[model samples]
Target: MAADPTHRAIEAVFRIERARLIATLARMTRDVDRAEELAQEALLSALTEWPKSGVPDRPGAWLTAAAKRRLIDGARHQSMLERKHAEIARERDAETDMSAEAIEAARDDPLGDELLGLIFAACHPVVSPEARAALTLRLVGGLTVEEIARAFLSSEAAIAARITRAKKAIAKAGVAFEVPRGAELRARLGSVLEVVYLIFNEGYAATAGPSLVRPPLCAEAQRLARILAGLMPEQPEVVGLLALVEIQASRLAARADVDGRFVPLTEQNRARWDQLLIRRGLNALDRAEALGGTDGAYVLQAALAACHARARSAESTDWARISALYDRLAEVVPSPVVELNRAVAHSMAFGPEAGLRLVDDIANAALLRNYAPLPAARGDFLFRAGRTGEARAEFEAAAALAANERERDFLLARAAACAP
Candidate 1:
């Protein structure tokens, strides 16, 4: 029998072309959100039409041309005032640029950085940081709302609503759909980095999946970081973020066991780390520091990761230096998550009670209430302090809160170890 195109294959097509499709459509339609809608409409057409007609050889080009045809048809059929008609007609002419070669250009980014522009467009400061993260992951990362919801430990409806609001917010603010330059570029780069790292962190430590890491998402974030670094080699912070993710990615093998259970950094086999990635990460960090990014959040964090990558054993790891880096990190990006990490570093450096004090101080904060790491850190400190019963309780709470099955199982195992 001849091979046939499956839905899964078609979806892979969408994932690969997602960023370019939205970028091309947004450029043509002069609207980011509408571009997403039209892209989906084209996908729908494919879903219905391709199974019967067979998959087109150039799926990306086909989707682009299909979406442009829809715009042309809508413009032709809709009634409008003379000026409005002329405007739509002009738009049609512009869309004709989305022919085979144009679609190929959009896909290839032949002469410009369309995807990067789309990244800035989705992450424009007009929307809230939360919205920017959600929208960028959607449009640029090619993630569905459900996947984002699971990563965030939030509801799909909430993510959907935030995406809707973000589009409207971008429209209302009249944020330009192009990459900024000069000082504006620096200011916008922070938001862009945050979105990219959010995607990376989700991949590094997935919240609600059977496995501990999602390689595809992690790879996607790294790819974006590399592209950014290529496009702007002089930017210290961009290089810093790239360094941080690269070093962290090197340890993926040691993050889990043969059965895919969670493995603490202290227990992971150091020999399993990827040397190439470590070299790249260290080189990137050296570049960042050479460019005077010592105080940057990502550079500081990369420094912290370097402490471990250089160590031959867990006991040889510099907990005191890591604690200091966390201390500086807390000042740079103050939050319960940062505080929790700092407390763990403190416990490793100054003993458990010192860290316990800090953890207890933020124990009741609303944001930390359901956050698994807060209790997990507390449990680790309590266990080290010989307060087994209290540690067991915290462990149980963390297990209950954990979203990843592997992480939850690991927590439960720790709780059992503390049984009196």
Candidate 2:
């Protein structure tokens, strides 16, 4: 069945401005769920109106105003609920004479700022990290429960439950809708960065899809990162994440072959890399460093990417420096993924044997049991060390474990290359 054009357009617009729409509604209504409801209502209205009236000159602003009206109507409808009645009465009285111009003006300036504040609020530390990620993706990334589930490789039911629980947790904990100040701001910023990075990473390398890249997610995350950087110029990690994404994204053109086959970093054509994006990435990284603080996870990751970017050729890559940076990153962040990457770096810097040993140590790590890359990395090292049979087996295992079709095909090809 074909998707309705109006529905698809509404989806596209919502994807682009979901964060701002929800942020504005949250500020006005002071309830996250209600704000989302209003935003959804506005989308439905657009689906009805846009096909007939055509898309508005400023679709975002139009949606914002429509959502605002829905909220107002909802508030008025609920005015009979005693305590709610007084709140609505007060808010209505406050905006009794609100003109179209006044409303438009209000939606323009502080509203956008408040929307960003709402993003920070939604990602507050009090929320569990998983919940934070799920909620941010739902509200800000504008992803459906099924889409979010697919991204995480979890069941749709599980994803829905997580989002439901997250919203309930926020309400139960009485989390504010406003942005934090001072130290609280710093802590919340970390959570926000994590959400943004997660979104970008998913886009850059979808865990399970026919397509190797999800460009929309990448563009959305980059947009959010840029907005955050602009809003908080002095925040080093914000700049760091932007830099990291930009640098990594610079290689997008080279990351795949002409037929959309996956191309590993070692095999990518350097000439196809976007120099403009690389330069922007470097400048952002410089800003992050200039802010003068201990490097965050994103900053460290960016530094590692910079090592690759500075190399004119794959052979000139400073594997030792990358290994050292990964070492520092592991000490700070300490994830199995970092350990896996560090092993790869060690192989490049030292020898395949050294990397193989490190991979052996983590072979049984619970976190990496289903992670295809572990076996894939081990296969690469084994192949390099002339252990053809072992490399073939590892690559086959990786192919079985991989979720994305493109990655599976890549691993299978590698496995076939090792066939006697």
Candidate 3:
């Protein structure tokens, strides 16, 4: 069955306005869960009434008003509870004197600092990193629990439990719904940025999905990163993250084939890449560097991307410089993923044999046991070195382990090409 046009329009508007809607409601109600519920209630009202009444001049404002009414109704019910009836009644009386028009005015404040405040609050230190990320994506990115679960390669039940526990933790710890200040702001903002980038990276590469890219998630993360960059233009890391995502996303068009099969960087069509986005990324990188942030992870990653952007062809790429940048990035971040990427740079800088050696070492390391890319990289190197039979086996193994259908097909095709 086809979806109603009105419903689709409401969904689109809600996706764009969801963060602000929830933020304003959370500020008023002081309960994240209730704010979400009220927002959903407003959405239901829109679906019911908008068709006959037609879309409003300000759909967001209309939704905000409906959600506020729902909140007021819920508060009235709370006033009847025996445990804190007196306090609830007093608060209700105070709220009665405040007109909905005034409340709507408050919600419509163009500054939207509340949205940023909500981001920091959702990513507060009281919650675990995983929980913080889950909640932020749910509340800010407007992603469903199932979508996040798919991104994390986990079950929907597990993601649901994690979000529940996160909310409980926030309430138990009495986390405030305001933004942090000074040094605390800096620290907490890093977690927020990490969550945003994690979502973008998942969408960009889709570690476990049928498609090579989830363009919606990438676009959403880029939007959030751009918002953050605008909100805090002085922050170097904010600029760095924006630069990194912009550059990476510029290559999305050429990252896959017409049939949705994966295309490695060396084989991608450079003309299909978005040069406008590349220029924006370079400008953002310049801003970060001008602010004296040189060695940060995102900044370094952007620098690596710039190397590719500058090259007219695969052979023209500055492999040595990329290897050096990877060296710096590995030192700063020091993760298995960074090391894996550094190996690729080394391979490009030297020879397939040099890359094979690095891949071999990583293969034996217990950490990459379930990582499909290790074998995939090895297969590519072997294929380039004229070891077709060995490459075929490796490619088949990679295809078997890969979760994404597009990547699996690419590997399978490569393996078939080596057939006798």
* lDDT of prediction 1: 0.85
TM-score of each model, paired residue for residue: 0.77, 0.82, 0.82
Provide the overall lDDT of each model, using Cα atoms, as 2-decimal numbers.
0.85, 0.83, 0.83
For lDDT, the strongest prediction is: 1
Poorest 10 consecutive residues of model 1 by lDDT? 77-86
The sequence of per-residue lDDT tens digits that candidate 3 reaches over residues 1-420 is 129776898788777878988987787667899889999998889888888998777777788878877766665686666535346446656766345455567566655678887887788778887788788889988889998887677899999999999889887877777778898888887888887787788889988767889887788789889988888788888899999999999999899989888899988899988999999999999999998879988889889998998788987999999999998998999877778888888888988898888777667777777677878788888888889999899899988999888988888988999865
Off by over 4 Å in 1: 1-18, 33-113, 128-131, 143-162, 360-366
lDDT of 2 by residue, 129-246 (tens): 7787788778876778887887776899998998888888777777777778888887778889988887788889987778788776777788778888888778889999999999
Model 3 Cα RMSD, Å? Answer: 3.9
Stretches of candidate 3 exceeding 4 Å from the true structure? 1-16, 41-73, 80-101, 104-111, 124-134, 143-162, 360-363, 382-393, 415-420
Q: List candidate 2 segments past 4 Å from native.
A: 1-18, 39-74, 94-96, 100-112, 125-134, 141-165
In candidate 1, position 208 carries an lDDT of 79
Residue 242 in model 3: lDDT:
95
